[model samples]
Target: MSSNSPADPPVRRIDRVLAFMALGIAVLSVLCFFAIMISTAAGMQHADYATGVWPIVAVLPLVGLPIAFLLIVALLIMSIVRRGKAGRS
Candidate 1:
């Protein structure tokens, strides 16, 4: 027997593509954050700075990560809402 339940709507190709993109972004961000944290920790332990560049370089990721996170979240939300609308149609 076959059913036509809303939960059983056929999956769209776009949704799968978007999901993979989001997953990639999440994985990249996690790695980026980990590297930043490790470098920051190392910089703190060995205070052998002459030009004060390490501190500024370390802060760059901390500042940019939040913005990237917000964008990724927005992308996921948009994809979900679009899929919901398509299902209703």
Candidate 2:
């Protein structure tokens, strides 16, 4: 039911690239967040809050990584919906 043939449209390529980029960012942020959490925990075990751990714990949790994950999910969902619509037409 679609006009597009075996080859994907150029727009699809751009979308794929963006999706991959988002995924990469999300993965990296998640890894970094876990590392920070572990470090924060270990730092707290010694009751030493002066090692700049609080800032990473406070700021990173409130921003950055969550935004990256949300962006990645949004991009992937959008891509899926668009691809479905394109295929149906």
Candidate 3:
């Protein structure tokens, strides 16, 4: 007896390639954001110890938010396209 119930599709090679690309982009973005945060913190500490001055608290979102938002939009578009293709089949 053979069982057949429209078995789920295996991961396609293209999907794997795209996944790795997405992962690499995400990791780079995160590392960049972390570096920004660390540098900003170090600057503040240095200012306090030297001149006793801590100016603006605008670093985390300034560089990180836009980069992340753009990536999210890109991923959204990719997913929508993928979904559209799957739907047609």
| Best-fitting candidate, scored by lDDT | 2
* Reference-based lDDT, each prediction: 0.63, 0.65, 0.55
Candidate 1 lDDT over residue span 7-88, tens digit each: 5556568657655665665566566667657876767455543246655554545655565566577666876787688778
Best by TM-score: 2
Candidate 2 displacement at residue 53 in angstroms: 7.1
Name the 10 consecutive residues with the lowest summed lDDT in model 3.
Answer: 49-58
Could you give me the TM-score of model 3 versus the true structure?
0.45
- Candidate 1: Cα lDDT at 36: 59
Report the poorest 10 consecutive residues by lDDT, candidate 1: 44-53
Segments in model 1 whose C-alpha atoms lie over 4 Å from true places: 1-7, 44-89
Expressed as tens digits, the lDDT of each residue in 1-89 for candidate 2 is: 66666634346676767677667666766766777678777665544544665555445544666776777777778777877876787
Tell me the tens digit of each residue's lDDT in model 3 across 3-82: 43333234456666656665665566576566557877667454453332222223433554566566566666766777
What value of lDDT does candidate 1 attain over all alpha carbons? 0.63
Better of 1 and 3 by TM-score: 1
